[model samples]
Target: MNGYDSALFENRTVVVTGAGRGIGAAVVVAFLGCGAKVVAHAGRDLSHTEGDLLSRVPQGARSRLTLLTEDLSQPEGGADLARQILDRTDRVDVLVNNAGTMGGRIAAGTETREDYDHILDLNIRSVVALTGALLPALKAVDGASIVNTVSISGRSGGSAGSALYSGAKAFVSAWTKTLAKELAPDGIRVNAVSPGTIMTDFHRRYSSKEKLDATAAAIPLKRLGTADDCAPAYLFLAANALSGYMTGQILEVNGGQLMP
Candidate 1:
């Protein structure tokens, strides 16, 4: 056995999309902590969190970090990003399709065709496209894994202004299971992380503290989840030593906000 075999993702190469901030960024950190080399992809040149936050993670950990910027909403963009990673690494053991967009005016007469198209393109299309583009790399790994970032809004109807967002995520959850089986033969596992209202920038934009408190009151956990809380699920899925047999499953991290 490898010296770091018990360390979960030791020596694995992990790619995290939309890793500029929030849960995506947290997942990147988690994978790095597990001894995996991380390729962080962001939609924009600017980071969602401070760039230095990751750079500060100790020199040894920082050595495993690489940042790539690409707009996944476009078909060419996804392919380009995948190619960039392939060019830099021999194999990718884990692919986290965590990059997505939310929020579209969903009120009656407010939803527009353009808004629907944009949300679907970013949240669903990009996930599908990127996964397809990276299939070869994932297949080459001994125990590769893919984790899609879904949302509880996908399972149930979302707030009044989230029709497109919810529908897009619903598609992600369903697609994740299908891909898991299709890729299993190649030793690649596919899964998803569906989070309920979490205290990320995404949630903060849609809700104020008072609003978040009221929403939390309705949840069983009596509080909103944090990015830190949801990140481990991705780490677990990425770590072959931990979740090698787990595939086609949706691990919800919502502070008990939504339960099966």
Candidate 2:
């Protein structure tokens, strides 16, 4: 179990949103390593992501990779992505909704409506829309599954300044549970992975080094989780042989930071 499973997803089709960088990028590499036909979806250019992924993805797996760019923040972006995927293939075996944004600290009266819109759109709306758009396709495939990327902030209702972000993720976590029940009969398993403080670009720009160090110290593991650490959880959740009976669950990858 320590070593990677090369043939776990021999011919599976996986769609990983926000695969441009950070955790999203790591998950894509994990899937590709397992012999999946993966579509890496990102809203921005793939200059750095392309390099980051290429270096990690084996030469033999290169042909199985597909880079997709679509802004999942917009209302129609989900439909557009579905169309794009369908045009290329008939079904998607795994859907990873990893595209998300770290919003500015919420100020009660000072925050603009656009701020809330942006945060909710990226963090929550796209997940709902994209999952809905892909529902039938997911059902068509055998052992299909959906893994959503959530946050620790969502569980605690956020820290001092991240109220809006906390709220959006909270909704995502709850929605994940509800979706699991609804899709269970369709043979689609839905689950969420909530990461603690991961050292990704999302934190590099917003989290101070001192703050990260402080948070790391608070964790029982005494370190922040890496994107690589969080990647395998998605595979575990998606692979029916591994988690066939698991659904509507939150697999926390927080280094024992939050026991719940």
List candidate 2 segments past 4 Å from native: none
lDDT of 2 by residue, 94-142 (tens): 9999988777666667777788777888888878888888888899988
Please, what are the lDDT tens digits per residue for candidate 1 over residues 34-128? Answer: 77888888556655546623643557687788888887666466677878888888678889998886854467678777777677778887778
lDDT of 1 at 12: 82
Name the lDDT of candidate 1.
0.80
How much lDDT does each candidate structure score?
0.80, 0.86
Prediction 2 global C-alpha lDDT: 0.86
Q: Which stretches of candidate 1 lie over 4 Å from their true place?
A: 1-6, 49-56
**Residue pairs with backbone atoms closer than 3 Å in model 2 (clashes):** none
List the lowest-lDDT window of 10 residues for candidate 1: 1-10
